[model samples]
Target: MYYDGIGTEANEKKGFELMLKVAKSSSLGAIHLKHHAQFNIGRAYFEGYGVEQNNKEAERWWIQAADDGSPNASVLAQTMLGMLYSRPDFLNLKQAFFWHSEACGNGSLESQGILGVMYLQGDGIKQSEASAYECLKEAADRGNVYAQGRLVQLFYNKKLFTKASDLARRVVAYTDVEELARDTGCLAAYITKGIAYACFYLSRCLALGNGLRMDKEEAEKYFKRACELDPVVSHDFHLDVAYGIL
Candidate 1:
């Protein structure tokens, strides 16, 4: 099953055969086998792995898994279906929003983040800054870095500078590696959240000549710390200051 052509495309047929073998011998293993088979097969078909790309097959498998009460599979299926319907070719914004909303309700952080993006951009849903904030915040609170970054963006877009600063500080404070080692689940997420918060605070400090004295040296230090902790932070424009390039 590890050789499925979904993520790596190693040996799909062999993988499926192995999964079937294990599934027949153990009920517990069967549940996981079924879930993986359904999800991976759907992904393979959707992405055209060893077979002609077919959204219909993908949708079918995802639906079956979801109906079987696989939370992860269900959320993914709903999200993908939402994306399919949201395209201009289909233009079913209401349907897209509905599916995404359902996925979010199923406790999918990815869905929450995607829905936040949709709400923020007014795609497949009416533009509601408040709604976007709520969605992103929900994910962020659960330690989703993408959602935390989006929350920062939303705050900045709406000129909620003070709130953004507060959030940024919180991000930096909560994402310490030391604290994370003591915690569990989503280490990468905490790191990302920390970087986002650090960047925001560093930017504000530079802009206002706050306690840090507006020194390029101090700013670079903080930026470097952020980048070292989370590579994604390097994509932010503040990276220049962090990397001492500025």
Candidate 2:
């Protein structure tokens, strides 16, 4: 409908009118059509494409689209809803948990990983190690880099070294830590708690060859990476002895 406008002159109003007509249709078997139309309508409002810019209106449409269960729109809505609830300013823990769970169940890898963290730390939901492990494992298995990193930390905390080492190797293959005070996904829970829980126990295994083959050079690499990610992990021999404290 806007094709003519694009070739001649910009006509956002005309585009918006056409989009509204399609979005208002009550026809069946038009799930994708409705979903996309609604999404575009929301975008139009948000971006002032053909209407007055209004975030509240945009969010309302997005929420409706998400609840409509259009696959793509649902995912987008899930993400938007999760982000809205997760914001420190909004801080609706119950709603955040609900939407994140919905998104996770719908295969949003980021939601799965974040939901796992919430479960592990009891931030928004009741802490349940079993649930945490299941969500984190699912996300990690899907090759989400951040999820893989967090899974390594979780398994390491549980003394599941084989699992930890396996995941750590996968993460190291893709990234390295340049800062300790950020969300690289691996140390987020540990950092936020300010307790220095030693997120890189598997790194020591690589360095000391305890259950894994000893490779001092590689150990040193992981040591530096760990320390940069969290200063608490300066390969503190004392923490190793005080393991149960964290």
Candidate 3:
């Protein structure tokens, strides 16, 4: 109640203290709740809620939680660890892949989507089109926007422009990207970035009439929208074009 003031005052210090107490307690009653407490403590350390921000400390608590927590908490911790390891400062592609794979096997939608990307990109693992297709197909069917967007790219690469355009259009139909991102409980940046990629693909389809009538003006509008969502989309698109991947 104190943490985010959900039902009371927002006292981060008290919240952190309480969480720490629960996490450290060895009582039988606290055992079940300890993992949850540990997860929150990890979040506190990662975000500096009450103590100074410390990625190392965050990693420690998260590892404990993932190893000994409830199924839900363990999956979340695994996903967080995957993201943390992917950070440039602590980049460990192998570890990132391992955690994501673990979380994916445990039914994390976010990890499932990311595994597809890793397979497609040969990131920390050998590229396997079949594996990528299976992961992306399953995740997209489960309403994962990231997987849908990547699938669009996969179709585009295979010259299945019609299918790619259709998928991209479906992705763009999601007007409330923020709400979707929040509801999915995945990293908002990843969700939004995927949407941005869909926008870029849709724009290219429109401009080139790849699977539909060519409309330069319509393409321009989508192009602008893609950039608005993520300015980096345009840069990435250009690179893809140079590499003939788009």
Candidate 4:
């Protein structure tokens, strides 16, 4: 409540202090909550909620929480570490890969989706289409939008326009495209970007009658939506279409 003012005035410093106290406490009363406290403290440091932003301190606290053996906190902390190491300022691909792999093994849907991308692009490891397919399929089956987008791209590359169109249709079926585009979290941004990719591909399918009937009006609408979601991506997709890259 103090942190975000759920029912009271926000007091980030007090929230951080309480979390730190819980993290430092070794009593049985605190054991069940300590890992979560540690994770929150790391988040506070990372986002400068109540303290100076310090990536090192964030990393340290997250590592402690990740190793604390609380399944939820451990997985969350590991996933956070992966995201942290992926930042341009941090830029530790190997570390990012390791932490994501760790989180994936712990059944983190986000990490599983990211691992698929890494395998597909060879970002921090050897590229393997087979591994990419496996990871993407697993995550997509479990409703990971990021993995679904990449899988749709894979299908498109393999000339499976029908499958791509089907999946892309599902991805963009939601009614909150504008809200998704405006979200600030990394995962939400990725989801919005993925939705844009899906829209671009779906528009192509409509225009070319590859997997659906040719509908110029619908195609234009979706193409415009792709641009609205992510203009940079839309521009790149437009160039690819121009160059017969699809």
Query: Whose lDDT is greatest here?
Result: 3
Q: lDDT of all the models against the reference?
A: 0.64, 0.65, 0.87, 0.85
Model 3 lDDT-worst window of ten: 68-77
Candidate 3 lDDT over residue span 1-246, tens digit each: 677789887999999999999999989998888877888899999999988899999999999988843365668888888889989988998888998898888889999999999899998789999999999999998888889989988998898999999999999888776788777766777777778878888888999999988989988988888888888867888788789766
Q: How would you encode candidate 4's per-residue C-alpha lDDT over 121-181 as one tens digit per residue?
A: 9988899999999999998888777678778888888889999999999988855644643
Best model number under TM-score: 3
TM-score of each: 0.59, 0.60, 0.93, 0.87
Clashing pairs in 3: none
What does the lDDT come to for candidate 1?
0.64
Q: Could you report the Cα RMSD, in angstroms, for every candidate shown?
A: 7.1, 8.1, 1.9, 3.1
Model 4, runs deviating above 4 Å: 68-73, 177-186
Tens-digit lDDT track of model 1 for 19-133: 4454344577466556556666667677776566887777776666555334555456666666667666657877778777887787766667768878988987789878888
Q: What's the distance in Å from true for residue 110, model 3?
A: 0.6
lDDT of 4 at 240: 94
Clashes of each: 1, 2, 0, 0
lDDT of 2 by residue, 1-246 (tens): 472375667678887887777778876756557766676677788677779988777778777767744346656566556656777766887788887778777767667877887898897788999998888788767644556666776876787777677667656654324343233333343332222223355556675464568787776666566666556444463376469443
